[model samples]
Target: MANHDTETTEKLEKFGKRLKELRKAKGYENYEQFAFKNNISRSQYGRYEKGQDIRFSSICKVLKALDVTFEEFFKGFD
Candidate 1:
């Protein structure tokens, strides 16, 4: 259970890093600006970037905002 928890945390962190990278690549220097533009809650988006857990539907919304497909988002992730 401990190992699983650790793995989950690591994955979440990686996801957050990837999200930030994509946001920068998309020309959004600030997460708040991105969130506001995309109609996402700025606070929640900040939490997500800080490696918090997010729902699948919310992730889908984020992906749409980022203009990335699931495959593209998860491309280099294990």
Candidate 2:
């Protein structure tokens, strides 16, 4: 349903925003630097931080690179 799609999109965007904030807090000024340091593709990481859909496995990898636990990553989710 359209509503479901909208909800998913909203959740993804919120997650992306949170990811960006966390990255900044870790002193990563650019996505390329973060991705490179984490062994992720820079373009893919950019997309992830831009609210685009990303794979769950990739999300896990990013969380690991950020030194964040799953619970910490999903904190404040509604």
Candidate 3:
């Protein structure tokens, strides 16, 4: 079970890093800027970008802001 937790954490962190890079590529400066535009808090956005095990609902909100699906967002990681 511990190993499973680690695997999930790794994936979450990878997702976070990927999200950060994509946002940067789109010309967003930082989590604060993205969050502001998306109407979320900077701290919350930072948590998602920094790996806090993002919830499905949060992902939905992010998808709306970034205009990308999870498949497309994660394809680069593959």
Q: What TM-score does prediction 2 earn?
A: 0.92
Reference-based TM-score of each model? 0.93, 0.92, 0.85
lDDT of 2 by residue, 1-78 (tens): 133487898998898998999999999999899999889999989989988878889999999999999899898899
Error of 1 at 15 (Å): 0.2
On residues 1-78, what C-alpha lDDT tens digit does candidate 1 reach at each position? 123487899998999999999999999999999999999999999988988888999999999999999999999888
Candidate with the greatest TM-score versus the true structure: 1
Q: Order the numbered candidates by lDDT, best leading.
A: 1, 2, 3
RMSD of 2: 2.7
- RMSD to the true structure for each prediction, in A, is 2.7, 2.7, 2.8
Candidates, ranked, TM-score: 1, 2, 3
Q: Please list the residue runs of candidate 2 whose C-alpha ends up more than 4 Å from where it truly belongs after superposition.
A: 1-4
Cα TM-score of candidate 3 = 0.85
What overall lDDT goes with each candidate model? 0.93, 0.90, 0.82
